[model samples]
Structures are given as C-alpha cells and as structure tokens.
Target: MNKIISALCFSIVALSVVAQNNPSINQADTARQQRETDQVLREVGPGDSVPSLFSEEDADIGPQTVLRKKKPTWFRGTADAQIFYTDNMFFQDGNEQEAGLAVTTVEAALTTPPCITRFASYRAEVGYRHQFFNYFGSDDVLAVPGTILTRRFDAEDFDFDSSTAFAEIVAQTKHYQFRAGFDYTRLLGFEPLR
Candidate 1:
C-alpha cells in the first residue's frame, strides 16, 4: 500500500511540471495579449497637438487690448450781484430824518487747476460796492448865543455817497489755507465829517 501511494504522488508532480513547460500554450497567450494592445491603440487614435480641455476658445473670448481717455481738470468761474434799499435810513434817537439809502454790490471769482503744484491750489476774486444816501433833514442846528435856542440848516449838508473796491488771493493745501487782500475806498458828500 505504501508503494502504490508513493507512485501516484510522483505521477501528479510530473504532470504539473510538463504542463508549465509547454511552449504552444505560452505562444497562444502572448498572441492574444498583443491583439488586445493593438485594439486599444486604434480606438485612442493619433496624439497630435490639441487645445486644453479646460481652456476657453479664441473666438469666444473678448478683446485683450482696450483704450481709455483721461478726464479734464479745469473748472468754471462764478459771478454775483446784489442790491438793497431802505426808505427811512436813520431812525436813531427817534429822529426819522426822512433819508433814503441804496446799496449795490458785484463780485467775481476764479479757481486754478491743480496743475500748478502737487500740494497746493490757488484762487482769486474781485469785488465792488457802492452806497448812496439822500437826506431831507437838516445837518446842523445853530444855537442862540449860549442860550440853547437854535435854527436848522439845509439837507444837502447831510447827504453822503461812497464807493469801495477790493481784490483777494487764496492759497490752499491739504491741511491749511491762507488768504491776503487789499481794499481801496472813496468817499463824497461829507468833507466836514471826514
């Protein structure tokens, strides 16, 4: 019985070794693997240079170069005029001197562009004003010789007129401002008072 078992085991080992060493079976497997690789290459096609799948097309994208214009830096000027009047100009001490007053004023201003300097700007202005007063009441009361008795004078002595002109310059910075100006004034109709 031991000899029969040993013979059967030796036969099985020899069959397995013969099957592993067969050249025909190995050739058939190599042929099948080569065919499969050829079929996969055919399906994938040639590999020419191609655009990226995630990138935008040239026709669908907007223009890459654009032109823009700069803005103007200058500003316009300003002008103003005003007039005022009063029927009874003098009411002090309940005098009711029956005087008429009229005043007229005019002004103009201009501003310069920042093209002058980096931190400062400038502006200029000029102004003119006129005043006229008509007096119907007496200017003086002549008193009797140290007695307090008096006589009234004519209204022409009390009438008055005046005119004034002024010019100004302004300089401005980020945190501070400065201004300088001059005025010229003329008076008429009251030489004794002046």
Candidate 2:
C-alpha cells in the first residue's frame, strides 16, 4: 500500500512539472488558433468589403481611406430689429428716467472650410456687425441741470451707432482646442462724461 501511494504521488508531480515546462504544447495551441483565424478570414473575404456604421455611400472601405468629405466654405448674414421701453435709458444708478428706443443689428460673415494637417484641423472666419440705437419719448431727460448722464450728450441727443469687425482662427486636435481672435469696435454719438 505504501509503495502504491508513493508511486502515485511521484507520477502526479512529474506530470505537473512536464506540463509546466512544455513549449511544444503551447506552440501547438497557437498554431491551431492561427489556422482557425485564417479559415474565418477566408470565409468572410477581404476586410475592405465590410460596411461600417454611418459610412458614406461613395466611400471606399479600407484602412487608409477617409469616410467623409470635408465641409465646404460658406457665407452667412443676419439682420435683427427690436423696439422696447426702458426705465433708465442712460444707465443712471440713483436717478431713473423712462424712455423707448429702436435698435437694429446687422451681421455678415465668411468662414473657410476646415484645413486638416498631420496633427490638427484649422478653420478661419471673418465677420462684421453694425448696431444702431435711437432713443425716443425722453423729452425731459435734459430738463434738469447737472444730471449724471446729461454731461455725456447734448440736450435731446440720445442716438448711438456702433460698428464691429472681427477675425478668428481655431485649431483643434484629438484632445485639445485653441482659438485666437481680434475684434475692433467704433462707437458714434456715445461719449464719456466730462
């Protein structure tokens, strides 16, 4: 009985050691997996013929092909007109006055299409805007002397116009985006207090 038990233990230990150090068994398994993968690939045909999600109708399916076309350059323009009443048209803090004003704004812009490089994509845009403000129903705004806002404008002169022009460039990468822009504004009929 002792001999049988010892022999059984020795065989088990030898089998474990041989299995742990066997390279041929591992190679045989890898070769079998590769053969199965090759067979599946052959049955499925080339990867280029597979259709991906949201793919364009004319796009070619391949590793190196682009799936979408670049956006085209465009031009846009907008105009808005509004009329409203305000309790304090001149922005006086302590003293308030009631007035109605008409406002108009116009904007136009042109944007270049995206330009893609090796590291990032870039776009450029240029725009201009013109805004006008004409005040009404404020006949008594200048009736009192030494008013806080009276020094900025002449009697009964509360019309204002402003023009702005801007240009900007944006660059975007996989994880970050950068933007640089400049704008210039010119104001008319608005002045600082004396």
Number of the top lDDT candidate: 2
Positional deviation of 174 in candidate 2, in angstroms?
Answer: 8.4
* Residue 144's lDDT in candidate 2: 43
lDDT per residue for candidate 2 within 51-163, as digits (tens), equals: 23345644654434334433485887899999989887657776577888888899999988877776888999999999988777866664344766454343238777899
**Stretch of 10 with least lDDT, candidate 2:** 45-54
Pairs in clash, predicted candidate 1: none
lDDT values for all models: 0.55, 0.75
Question: Tens digits of per-residue lDDT for model 1 on 1-194?
Answer: 99999999999999999999899999988887665654453344334222322336435663232233244434343343433344444434444344333333333333344333455677766666565544443455332323566445555555566776767777887578888998888887744455
Q: What is the lDDT of candidate 1?
A: 0.55
Q: After superposition, how far is residue 132 of candidate 2 from its true place, in Å?
A: 1.0
